[model samples]
Target: MLTELIEIIKDTFLPTIVVTGDTALKTDLALDSFEIINLIGILEDKYKIEINVIDIVSLITLEDICNYIANKKMP
Candidate 1:
């Protein structure tokens, strides 16, 4: 999940992981509301899971996303 999220960040944002870690999604990535929405859509389609908008709002870093994805996968 971390690797996939890293790839998404690299493809979506020009910033490398060096400057931003997990939190880069909200900070260094500079992703706006629309971008976040698009990202959620991409993730949902690729992961085959339904993501709530509230989750997106609460997410602030790469670790957050990774943890969220992991939690969703757990039984």
Candidate 2:
């Protein structure tokens, strides 16, 4: 799941630098508000789960997003 998320991010942002789970989303990925919305939409479609804006705003790092999706996948 993490690898998939990384691939999505890479494809979306086309970052020239390497990205890791600990990377800060805003500072490192430089994702703007529109890109963040796009990410959430992609994640929802990929994971088949609903993610709210508040949940997205709370995410601080790539790991946070991965963990959020993992937890949502749990019954």
Q: TM-scores across all candidates?
A: 0.82, 0.92
Candidate achieving the largest lDDT? 2
lDDT of model 1 at residue 21? 44
User: Residue-wise lDDT of candidate 2 within 1-75, one digit each (tens)?
Assistant: 778888888888864668889977788888888988988999999999998888888888889999999899999
Off by over 4 Å in 1: 15-21
Where does candidate 2 stray beyond 4 Å?
none
- Put down candidate 1 lDDT per residue, 1-75, tens digits, no spaces: 777777887787654555334465656777888888888888888888888877887778878877888788788
What is the Cα-based lDDT of residue 53 in candidate 2? Answer: 81
Clash pairs, candidate 2, are none
